[model samples]
Target: MTATAVQRFYRYHAYVYDFTRWTILRGRGQAVEQLKLRPDAQVLEVGCGTGLNFSQLLARLDPRRGWLTGLDFSEDMLARARRRVAAHGWSNVSLVCADAARMDLGRRFDGILFAYSLTMIPDWLAALERARTHLEPGGRMVVLDFGRFERWGPLGALARGWLRLNHVETRRPYVETMGSLFDRVEVHGRLGGYWFTAVGSNT
Candidate 1:
């Protein structure tokens, strides 16, 4: 989807995003925990829709000592995220409305995360490359997204079609791409291979 389409889509969905996504969007908390963020680490969350992962991230990385930046292309989504930040009193959390593929924050980060966002990106490879450039040496990058079903049966086909309707390209080789870009990469399948979590590092 183009940025405009995504924005318009979220304009309506943003209202119930947190509540609705909680059941289907799995592994986000695990992905954040896997980052193993340091107390003073600088972290970036690409496509951080509605700030769903903020609580988990803030729990792991103290706001007094660490900083978190959440970036998303949809203004509607970021609007909800802004509310989340304020409600939680996360003074150290920042939200930016911009294209993640081309965003340049004028600084690198100790850790970066993409939760259920890569498949929605048309130029996912470019976004991955850009994320690599934004990571400081030894920085970690974590991804949690839909993957091809391990068993492509009738149920798998139905699931794939349903996800496609939601603007998710489940066939994308997210793990393979991350493995190619990062020196050290670890991946784990989840939800019967319908989803996956990957952790990579720039050593």
Candidate 2:
């Protein structure tokens, strides 16, 4: 999609972005917990909309040590995120507008996260690969998103339908595909069958 189109899609939702989506998307805290960063670790969050997860990360992080960076394609979302970061005086944090599928930041990170963002991205596989490139060796990457319902039993279909209403869907081939790059890949779900989390580390 054109930058304008992506902007238009998120612009209208930027104001109520966190509230509207938080109710349904789970696994964020778990995703953050899985990062397991070291003191002074460089961390990057992809598709960081409105700084929702950033706030959580900041709260759990020691600003005196680790560094945090957030990137998104939407200007509207980044604007709100900037306000949040500034309001909290989070000097350790930085925000940028870069496409998840294409970024040349000239740096690597110890941890990378995509919290409930893969499905909404148009070229998610490329984004995953790009994230892999940004990871330091032995670095961990985490993902949380709408999940496959097949394992959710009878309610699976209904849960997927609910996600569809919000323009989100699970990427089924995520683990099988990402395994080729990351030495280890584990994908799991929660929220009564609504969301998923994947963790991977480069060999």
Candidate 3:
């Protein structure tokens, strides 16, 4: 999907994302655990729709010193995230309405995540490239997203088709792209290739 269609898709999905995504969007906790963030780490989540992953992320940081930034292209999604932050009284958290592929926040982060967000990007390679620039040296970037379902046999095709209808491209070489951009890359697939996590360490 193009950038405009992606924005439009989330404009409506933003309302129900928190209520409905638990069934399909998996591995958030495991992926966050893989990040291994420090108490004073600075965290950034690209394509952080509705801030669903913020609580898990914020829990890992030092409330007094650590900071979290949730960035998304959709204003509607960021609005929900803003409300979530306010309701939870999380002062260290901030939200940015910006394109993931072209964002320049003027500072690098200790941890960067793309939880089920990378595949939805049209220029996913550029998004990875941008995230790399935003990563601090010795930092880690973890990406958790839908995989190609290669282990599911015939059902894999059906699952990929369904995700494509929703604007997520499951067939892309996400792990390979990370290997090209990062110093060290580790990949893992879960639920028979239904989803995956790629951990890239910056050297």
Candidate 4:
């Protein structure tokens, strides 16, 4: 699928995303922990839908010293994030609507996160490369995404197929691509390959 198609997919999903995603999207808080953020760090979250992870991210950040930039391809999704940010009166959080694979914000971040967003990106390798360029040396990047259910037997295929119909491709070599880009990488899979987390540290 193309970037435009992905944006279209989120147009409607954005409305129901916050309410319905809890069923399948798990381990988000733990993934944010992998970032190991400092109170004054500059963080970037790619595809931060509805800003669902903002509370966890912001909890680790000092609004007076730290800042967050949330990027998404769909304005509909961003609109939801904007409301969430405004409702909480979070001044340090900002949202941008742009394609992850092609965005060049001309700056780097201390901690970069791709939570459940990487697998949905069509040019996922490009997105990872772009994210690497936007990461500071010694900074860390965290990827929490759907994993290939390597051991789930028939259920694995069913899960993968269902996710594909929703425009999320799980078979891509996402972890391998990150291994090639970062200085050091560690990966962990959860619940029989239901999801995975990759922490890439740039040395």
Q: In terms of lDDT, which candidate is strongest?
A: 4
Report the lDDT of model 4 for residue 100.
95
Clashing pairs in 3: none
Worst 10 residues of 1 by lDDT: 1-10
Query: Which scores higher on TM-score, 1 or 4?
Result: 4
lDDT of model 3, residue 92: 96
lDDT of candidate model 1 versus the reference = 0.88
Q: Number of backbone collisions per candidate, in order?
A: 0, 0, 0, 0
Q: On residues 5-96, what C-alpha lDDT tens digit does candidate 2 reach at each position?
A: 66687889998887787676677789998988776788999999898888677766678988899999999999999999889889999999
- How many pairs of residues in model 1 come into backbone collision? 0
Worst 10 residues of 4 by lDDT: 6-15
Mark the 10 consecutive residues where model 2 has the least summed lDDT. Answer: 163-172
Report the lDDT tens digits of candidate 4 across residue range 102-127: 98999999999999999999989889
* TM-scores of the candidates in the order shown: 0.96, 0.90, 0.98, 0.98
Q: Clashing pairs in model 1? A: none
Shift in Å, residue 165, candidate 2: 5.0
Q: For candidate 2, list the clashing residue pairs, or say none.
A: none
Residue 15 local lDDT, model 4: 81
Give a tens-digit lDDT track for model 3, residues 33-136. Answer: 98899989999999998999999999999999999999999999999999999999998999999999999999999999999999999999889999999999
TM-score of 3: 0.98
